[model samples]
Target: MPVPELVRPAPPPTRPGLALPRPAAFACTGVLLGLFLVGSTTPSPMYALYQQRWHFSAIVLTEVFAVYAVAILAALLLFGSLSDHVGRRPVLLAAVVVEIVAMAALGFAPNVGWLFAGRVLQGLATGVATSAISGALLDFQPPGSNRGPLVNGVASGVGMAVGSVLAGALVQYAPGPTLTSYLVLIAAFALSLLGVLAMPEPVPHRRPLRDALRPQRPTVPAGRGRTFALLATTMLASWTVGGMFMSLGPSVAKGLVADAPYVVGGLTVAALAGVGGITQLVLSSWSGRRAVRVAAPLMIAGLAGVAASVLVGSAAVFFAAAVVLGVGWGLMFMGGFRMLTGLATPEHRAGTSAMIYVVAYLSASVPSVALGTVSTVFGLTAATLAFAITAAAFSLVAALATLGHR
Candidate 1:
């Protein structure tokens, strides 16, 4: 017999533990995400107050918030996939510089136009940062059995909540609300910059910035489209409600809560956001059968609860409903994101995520801003009802589309 060929044995599969992130790197990554997210919503709570100070109409508020969404969409369309080619660090660094400029502009803004310009640039920075930031933070977590997304998601949510709450409180009780708010943020932004620098660059893609600027819309197998659509719709429902809360919930609470501290207003938004962020932790990893099945029902119920709170006109009841709505929002968002990520190829992940964001941010901007303008004319009651109705309808569509997933 011929001597047996000596084939080299394949190397042992590297376990996740071997890939475990250094403790310092992991912690810093989480902090970076937190800082970025906190800055994202710092302006949300202050918008209503700005109205009080500057005497702008709700329409203007909508214009301001809408501008941010517009910028975000434009950036995502232009640069969402750039990290895939250039390396996450460079894109994130560029994002940091832009964010700093935004904060500075907001700090000293002399006119509504300046406010609008500041918000638009801020949105652009966030758009680029989030896609790479979330993934970068996840990289630090051990692959299996590590609550990677949840940790990152919760950090993102908490950061958002703190920014709003803190900014609102500082702006309300302290002198120079705008100036002080940005001063704190300037420090936070600087820290985010430092964190990004310390992180090792993810592998480079060897492509040009021009290549990344082009669209890479995802088209999964025909069989998987419904699966993909289900998640998309679910997010649509949840984020629609999110849009309502972010843009107008503070103003609504301001009317009913009577002499509400700016702190309360900020916390009100934070309360909903915090719950949604936490609920994501449970929903993302549940062993319960058919997590997706429950997502839509929860969203519908949450929408109903929000509608009820609006009709009842009780601030306490309103916040309670917000908590329930948050839970629903978390379930739907996490469920949808998981499905979206799973269904896409690595090449298309960033673009697809941006597409989902496009639907979400548009829903957030148009309705919320419309209500902002409407509240100026028809008053808060009509605007509140309008928002709830839109959210309800959106959820119904999502639920039905996702039913096929079962």
Candidate 2:
């Protein structure tokens, strides 16, 4: 009798429709995050093309790059934790739409001013999406799993690599080199919008949107200042390397191999990013602190190798040094991110993630702009040597600090 009473099929389960399965959601979120980076770097291979078309100075080129980083910092400071209050899906959806507009601006632009405008838009979109997407990965992570940071690290490096390589090939071989890559990105983002629409909102109880919109200063949890400082140091060192490669690797490659095809520029970036991605996966089992300790020295050595490669004009040596740098970059990123995420509770995950990126993009932007200016005045080789020395010194300090901190 009881069984018969329960046989009414439970009213067809009125839950409004199934949410995207957690596994699917996790994968989709990762892919969307990667797409954002891909969009950012897709312009890297084309910077030379832009310079050729516009006759801009190296300083101007770096300014264009620096502007993007500044916009990202502005957005990150303002909207970093917004998703924690208003829910992830809405924030992500809006950002993606903005990203599509940015791609269009870059792809169809008639002048350098439009390029600057497009980069600012793209940077805003990326900054808004970064915290939300990274937070979503943490929210959707499988129970007892620690894959969130790994995914973030790997996605970043791999995405940049794919963007650079794909754009390079398109520029070298495709008809509409400047337009094709961004069009592809536009279409990819359009599909990502659908995925975001379907993604389940991970934030269960959202706060008031107006209050969340207030700009918040970046902060670490109380009593974690030393840990935060160490992590910041590591991030600064690692991401600065990334910044340099992304902004100037192609140009450096061209300098080394004068007759190489456009694809070499992309390969210059891919060597660092692609190898870094693989290194992260291979070293996923290592502890964060240990990875950083090991990575710092490797980075120092790699920087020395890079400087030597430039001095000798050896493309082979440059690529090899890039691989070394990639390994160091991958380990430091993975380790530092793991530590960074550990510093946050679920309540403040997005804000904390934003703070680390603030450090990262700052390192990426300021020094890169300086390097560009130096290149304009001193020459690329001299600028690169200075960059190498500075980066190596930072790496040493980071390692020493990490060791001294307990």
lDDT of 1 by residue, 245-330 (tens): 77777787777677645776787778777877777665666622254457666666666666777788777777777777777777
Estimate the overall C-alpha local distance difference test score of candidate 1: 0.69
| Pairs of colliding residues, candidate 1 | none
Candidate 2 lDDT over residue span 278-354, tens digit each: 89888889987888889998898899989999999898898899999988888887777667767776666555766
Model 2 Cα displacement at 150 (Å)?
Answer: 2.1
Among residues 3 or more apart in sequence or in different chains, the pairs in candidate 2 whose N, CA or C atoms overlap within 3 Å are: none
TM-score of every prediction relative to native:
0.86, 0.90
Strongest candidate by TM-score: 2
All models, RMSD in angstroms: 8.1, 7.9
- For model 2 the local lDDT of residue 118 reads 98
TM-score between model 1 and native: 0.86
Question: Model 1 segments beyond 4 Å from truth?
Answer: 1-21, 143-146, 204-206, 217-231, 287-292, 345-351
